[model samples]
Target chain A: EADIYQTPRYLVIGTGKKITLECSQTMGHDKMYWYQQDPGMELHLIHYSYGVNSTEKGDLSSESTVSRIRTEHFPLTLESARPSHTSQYLCASSGTRSSNYGYTFGSGTRLTVV
Target chain B: AQTVTQSQPEMSVQEAETVTLSCTYDTSESDYYLFWYKQPPSRQMILVIRQEAYKQQNATENRFSVNFQKAAKSFSLKISDSQLGDAAMYFCALRQGAQKLVFGQGTRLTINP
Candidate 1:
C-alpha cells in the first residue's frame, strides 16, 4: 500500500480565508508533488519538489505555494481561498531509485471555498 | 515537454470479459516512462502498470497488461477478466527521468455485472 498521507480529507472555508493542506510520507521519498483535480476531471499538476528546500511550479498555474523543509513533509498553502480554488488536491511521492520511480499517491483533500 | 492523451472519455465492459483503453503520448526525448493509474470513487491515484521506453517487453501485472508501441507512440491498457473493482477513472501518465509526471484527461471505465 502507498504510505503517503494527506490531512483534512475534506474542508470547507469561506472566501478570503487562508488555508493550508498538509502532506507527508513515511517511505522516505525524495520527490513530492501536488495535483489539483475537479470531480471526475483531469488532474493538473500544481507544485512539485525534488527534495528539501527545493520547489518548482508545475504545468498549471496555481495561487497556492508549497514548502519542503523536510523530506517527509510537503505542505501547500493558499493565501486567500476562493470559490474557484475548490477542488481535490492530491499528494504523491517517489523515491530516487529507478525501481521506485512510480508515484505513491495520497488519498487527497477535497476543498470547498464557499 | 511531453503530452499524454487518452482519446476515450469513457469505456465499459462486462464482468469476466476483457477491455482495452487507448492512450497515446508525444515526447521528443528518447528515454522516458509511461504509466497507467486508476482512480476510484475515493479519488486515490493507484499505479496500475508501468512501461519503460527502452524496454521492448510489455509490462504486466496480473490481470493488467499494456501494449506499448514506441514507434507509434501508443500505450494501451488491456484488462483481462474485468472486475467491478476496475470501474474507475484511468489516467495515462508520462515522465522523463526525474521530471514531474504529466497526465492525460483520463478514461472512465465501467464494468457491467
Candidate 2:
C-alpha cells in the first residue's frame, strides 16, 4: 500500500545527544513537510521540501534541519537535543496538483529529551 | 500568510447526539481549500473532509458534514450520531495554491457515554 512512514514512533534521549527522525513515503509525492506538535496544541511547520534537492524553513523558527535527497525520503535531525525539544513530530506529503485532497500524514514520532 | 483559528478549545457530546466544532480563518486570497482532520490518541492525523473555495455545496462524508460560509471565512464541522470513536482532537486547516497547510489550534472533542 502507498503510504507515508515514520520510524522510532517514540524516542527518549539525553540532553545534547544527536538524534534523527526518519520519514519516508511511498505515495511518490513531490512535496513533503515536517511539523512539531505539543500536547493539546496546534501543529507548527518546521520544514518543507518541494522536491529533491529543494528545502525551506517554515513559518516557525526551528533548530532542526531537514534534507530531501530522494523523492521518498525527508528526514529531520536535531544536532543537540534539549528538554524543551520534546514534542511529537509529524511527517506529511502532498502532490502538486491540488490541495483538495489535503496532505497525507504519517503516524508521527514522539521524542522526549531528558 | 494564511491563518486558521479554532475558537473552541474543547467540546463534548453525548452518544448519538450531534455537535459542531467551530473554525475560522484569515486570508487575502480568494481561491483556496479547507480541510478538517481528526487526530486520535494514537496521534495519527486523518483527513475527515475537504471543501473547495469555488464550490457552493458544503462537503460531507457519512455522518460528518461541514457548514462552510465562504464570505464570512467560517468553516465548521458537524458530527451526527456521535460515537465513542469520534472522540479525538479535530483540526481545521487551510491551503492556498501550492503553499503548505496552516492548521488551527484544534478542538478536542470528547464523546460522553
Fnat values, candidates in order: 0.69, 0.81
List DockQ for all candidates: 0.67, 0.80
For candidate 2 chain A, the 10 contiguous residues with the lowest summed lDDT are A93-102
The reply for model 1, stretches above 4 Å from the true place, is A98-100
Which tens-of-lDDT digit does each residue in A18-66 have in candidate 2? Answer: 9999999998899999999987668988899999999999878999999
lDDT of 1 by residue, A1-114 (tens): 539889999999999999999999999899999999977688988999998999999889999999999999999999999999999999999988843357999999999999
Highest DockQ among the candidates is held by which one?
Answer: 2
> Candidate 2: deviation at residue B106, Å?
0.2
lDDT digits (tens) for residues B1-113 of candidate 2: 78899989999999999999999999999999999999999778999999999999999999999999999999999999999999999999999878888899999999999
Report chain A TM-scores, every model. 0.94, 0.96
